[model samples]
Target: MSELVEHVDERDRVLGVVERGEAERQHWPHRIATTICRDRAGRILVLRRSETHSRFPGYYDVMVGGAVDGGESYEEAAARELSEELGVREPVRFMFKFLCREGTSPVWFGVHEAVVTEPLIPDPGEIAWQGWLTEAELCEVVDQRLFVPGGRKALRRYLESGSGSGAGELGAE
Candidate 1:
């Protein structure tokens, strides 16, 4: 079972601890993660969550992401999630960190960006569909409300930066 770290208010102050299941049921604020995957052409990868997920099921989101463990750093969680969800073996660079509070529970969100030069194998349980889009197309989705609220915010930040820093810093080719 997944474990969750608890927090307080919209600011994400630490409260106490709770099990992942309990936290989900109780709507406790916790840390959420997001990763941006860029192809050699600078297109970004996005995916649709499996319909089986309890929250935001079947919604389009970042390439890979998840909740952070109790003592995990944002960068570690982002890197771990990338490998876990997409079978990516390259190192992930840190980008921006933001908080998303649109849900019943607030989320301390970390945005990371990575450039992929190899093949990707997405986790079926976490991803139902995947595709690459230009910045304009991605922004259009955000405008049309195609992504979850937190994802929208994260994407906007990424686009505005003109860098995938929301995902991470790109390495030299």
Candidate 2:
């Protein structure tokens, strides 16, 4: 059985539950939880999507996340994605949320941050390469590489929010 997602409207009200693929194909708005992981040294954990990934193949992303499952809160989805993608079970600080209109379909993006204290074990199926990069280095890479569009927008918003201040900067956690 395929995964189900909560289909929402422009104001983020749940309309109904739909298959993830159907939601994407039909351009239905849905919720996605994205977590930006940073290590002790204040470096961002970046990863390249596997070549066989469905949405954006072989693209680099600063955030590790996915669609929010039906009946799940954004925070719940973020935590699940963090553990599933990077094998980390840390507390994620909720940053903010916005409707990402740059992608194929509009998605309410719940942006979050987490301090990773353990060794990262990236899932091979979702991530092809993984590394830690300082904010400066990440900026350079984001400019030179082909990044996922929604991720790029999310990073821009995160930086503009003035909360990208290095690691251990958990606010309101």
Candidate 3:
């Protein structure tokens, strides 16, 4: 089935809806929900995309996310993606939202957070591997440009949002 994705404007107001594949192929503006999963120890879970996937395959990603389907709110999409991709069913607290464009691709990036309280059974077909890393560890790799473009952008925005304090500092985060 072709997934329907919400297309939004610069202000994040939905302009219309389009097929997910076409949205990607044409770089249409869409809404996506990203969750930065953490555990009690404050380590964040990262996933490596399956090599067979079409976009950024085999790249590391600190955010587990996906398109906001037509008729779905960002919160709904966020929770759904966490369960589908990482087997997380805990309550997720929304952190913030922003609109960004990289080259032609654009997204209303909704950032969320949650302390993962259950075992994550990643779908092998979508995730090649998964690991937990500290903010410092993630920052090191992100500085090296070792993450998917969206992940890098999202993480940078997250760090900036806290002004490198609060939850932004790596080792102390």
Candidate 4:
């Protein structure tokens, strides 16, 4: 069976649940929970997506995340994605959310953050290359590499809002 996602409206109201593939194929808005993992020294965790992955294959991403499962809250999904993708089980702090409509489809994206104190055991199916980059290095790579679009936008927003110094405001679409 395919994964399920919570279909949401523009205002982020849950309408119903749908297969993740169908939701994307039909351009239905859904929630994606992304966690920006940071090391104790404050460097961001970055990874290259697996080439065979469904979305944004082989692209570099500064965050690790996925679709929000049906009936799951953003925080729940954030923690789940962190553990699933990076093999870390750290507590995630709610950051901010925004409507991202610039990529494959529109998605209500919830951004979270966690300080990873444990070594990562990245999922091979989801991550190809992984590393920790300082904020300055991240800025350089974001411009130098073919980064994931939604993640790029989120990174921009994240930086503009003081690079996770505080809870960011509800961002514009």
Candidate 5:
């Protein structure tokens, strides 16, 4: 059976529910949870998507994220993505929401940040590998376009929003 998720308009008001695949095929605006995590030393956790991923396979990502499941709030989905992809249930603070317009991967994206004390354990199903990078190093990687194009934009927004310094704002979409 196909999982259903809330479908929304550009303003992010729920229009109805639809199957994930159908939503993607139609480019319906759905919700996604994007999260960036850091450790005590303030090194950011960067991950690479699995080669088998349906979208952006084998692409580097500055965040761990996934589609928001049915009935899940953005905050809930952000935390869930962190737990599912990194085995960390740390508190994720929502930064902002944006309508990504890069290409076919359009969606209402919620940016979040979390701090972890435990070691990160990446799920092989979702992530190919994981590593910790300093903020400067992350800038270099982003400049190199090592991450998915949309993901790179999100990361840049997150950084400019001052969320990396423990300040985050919930910007309107």
Candidate 6:
């Protein structure tokens, strides 16, 4: 399916409409996206992007993520992505938001983390590789630039804050 996207100013207010490709190419107004991080036992789930992706192909990143639909809240978008990408429907706890201006398209991104005790059933087309990593090991991977730049920053901030709790400002009802 083609991506549905909108251009927005630095404050995340809509400025105009643009095809996803044009927005990325021109770094038009910022867009909204979300990342989901899941922990199981003492390890976190991470995945390598399919080499076919338009951006950051072959890079390892947080378990699940995608662009938020117009008018969808970050939590809603995150939960939808979790289920679509991993076939997991567990509740997601809010982490934080990260602004990524380094990409072809600047983005206002939300970060979420969840704990999963059940086995994951990931979509092969969406993920090239998947594995569990300890927190320290994950940080090492981040240091080595394994994850998308914005993802790395969000993960670091989440870890440093020591709050596994949700932000409370937004939640799935």
TM-score for each predicted model, relative to the true structure: 0.84, 0.92, 0.88, 0.93, 0.90, 0.83
| Candidate 3: count of backbone clashes, pairs at least 3 residues apart or interchain | 0
Q: Clashing pairs in model 1?
A: 111-166, 112-166, 112-167, 112-168, 113-167, 113-168
lDDT of 4 by residue, 1-173 (tens): 99999899999999999998888889999999999889989888889999998898999998889999998999999999999888889999888999988778899899988999998999999999999987777876786798988888888788777864432332342
Tell me the deviation in Å of residue 116 in model 4.
0.3
Residue 113 CA error for candidate 1 (Å)?
0.8
Error of 1 at 28 (Å): 3.1
Clashes of each: 6, 0, 0, 0, 0, 0
Better of 1 and 6 by lDDT: 1
Query: Where does candidate 3 have its weakest 10-residue lDDT segment?
Result: 164-173
**Model 1 TM-score, 2 decimals:** 0.84
Model 2 clash number: 0
Candidate 4 Cα deviation (angstroms), residue 120: 0.3
User: Candidates' lDDT values, in order?
Assistant: 0.74, 0.87, 0.79, 0.87, 0.81, 0.70
For candidate 2, what is the lDDT? 0.87
Please give the ranking of all candidate structures by lDDT, highest first, separated by commas: 4, 2, 5, 3, 1, 6
Ranking by TM-score: 4, 2, 5, 3, 1, 6
